[model samples]
Target: MQASGYSFKELLGFDIAVLSELFSSYTTLDATRHNELMLYFEGVNKAWNHPGFTFLYHYQQYVELDAEPYSYTRFFEHYRRKYPKEKGSMKLQHIAGEEMFVDFAGKKLQIVDKHTGEVIAVEVFVAILPCSQYTYIQACRSQKREDMISCCTAALRFYGGSPKGIVSDNLKSAVNRSSRYEADINRSFKDFARHYNCVINPTRSYAPQLFNIKTIYNI
Candidate 1:
């Protein structure tokens, strides 16, 4: 009933800017969801007369709407996050020759051991540049620690210059624990990183969709 009662308290104790952001960014109805939700809001808009009364009624209607089956709190947080987005600048130490994303995929090829007549399935590793699409590949027994270190050094030499940075997936040999925003780079990898004056960053486990390598020079 009184703006003075709440506004003064909110102004002093709460972040008005944050509250404004929360309210403004709130998605009234997700287009990806049911169309009925949209129609409900539109109906409230046309039916209501007074500004204060309409806003209050619509606010209640929004929460109470039977169409929204899931938790609205979760919906709000979901919309708040730009989940499928690339944020921050890629410090890009190398425009011409700096950083490379190195990784191994699960796919493997069967190698026929000439000496033993044994069928050995070998995993393939690839290091690539996001900008140039240039790639290097090697076949190894598995994605082991030694194999990782060897493959990276060979790939760099194969490319003709030492790259300034290396990006990798949170594989067992590379990362101990994987995080969406950050991951732990292993000790040996850190040594390799320090030797070359390069940085090693593992991709967030949450963001597996972004991982794909293409061979630009060959294609």
Candidate 2:
């Protein structure tokens, strides 16, 4: 075969550019679908144990989009290459000014009354901003509904602004009933969210939907 006129380096560069362009083209993939895929990955990772919990399964829900969906294998490959850490536990993305995570610290602190020699053990409220990992902590009398709400409000003030929403574990002070689909948030907590123009999102420690999904996958 006759030798090509172009240098090996030049040919390689052209090939890369063509592949990148084709990969991002509207028919193969578009900005909308790309964004949706990232969000989907994030959601599924957090609730991976959720029902029908697979990328292919979730892709089925986006069939109406104009762009053709990538093949299941390709989809998984692309996401894994882009977000390897997501496959591991204890990895999460926090958007600054978007969300605040609240919980009571496992430890307690002592408060000494100035007037008397009595000491009080107080619960510690902890709120974290996912993006910056900045924390706001306060000592509260207890994890009662009122105290929880007060601490949340104070955390917002300390942070200098309010987030779009707040996330908490299913605690009675924050959640009335924990459900897989939607946990019932406490009325007082709901009011606090309204007052700050934010939302309350509660997560259960044990997921029920995970069980259903595993059963379906097994069958």
Candidate 3:
């Protein structure tokens, strides 16, 4: 086979540095979709202060002027191969109606009282069924047991069915005491789960991977 005389930069139209920057941006932005990362690259190229620091410009030129198709999917596949460490672990298969994951969003939502004109930061409760990826979100005043139960009830009502188990974070409202082996579920939360014919499975303390619905689905 005859080897092409073109240099690597000539073949790819962009140098390795640009590719490295793109990868850095992908990780920093935490982009879940390939097109979203590509869009960010395009935006950076357009708004870059330094004309020499171009990103995706040559790729777009090749696609538009040279009749080559741009494939973000293929680029991402190659990127994953090149950066194996960035790949996530294998996802566990979930059974339908088996489990629902619930947690409060890390960031609080704000609401302004109409009468008092006071801004109140509220907790955002989220629930997701792993198999179907169905989600329920509600804003509550706090993560108190009553509020948590209320949110869970609303989530169940929204789904119109309860799962076999509810996976919850080790918050005080859900778990009375967190442990590595077996956490203690709060009395009210336990009763709520029992009423729904489901079990409350509290995730171990400091182990967010056990309740990783958000990480899996980018919720």
Expressed as tens digits, the lDDT of each residue in 93-165 for candidate 2 is 6676998888876557799999997999998787878787677778999999989888987998899999998
Candidates 1 and 3 compared: the better one by TM-score is: 3
lDDT by residue (83-181, candidate 3, tens digit) is 456546786899999999999877677899999999999998989888888888899999998999999999999999999999988888988789999
Give me the runs in candidate 1 sitting further than 4 Å from their true place: 1-94, 213-219
Instruction: Using lDDT, rank the candidates from best to worst.
Output: 3, 2, 1
Give candidate 2 regions above 4 Å deviation: 1-90, 207-219
Comparing 1 with 3 on lDDT, the higher-scoring candidate is: 3
Q: Over the stretch 100-217, how does candidate 1's per-residue lDDT look in tens digits?
A: 8877754566899899999999888888776676778899888999999999989878988777778787788989889877788789989988987889877778675334332122
Q: How many backbone clashes are present in model 3? A: 0
Between candidates 2 and 3, the one scoring higher on TM-score is: 3
TM-score of each: 0.53, 0.53, 0.62
Worst 10 residues of 2 by lDDT: 210-219
Clashes by residue pair, model 2: none
- The TM-score of candidate 2 is 0.53
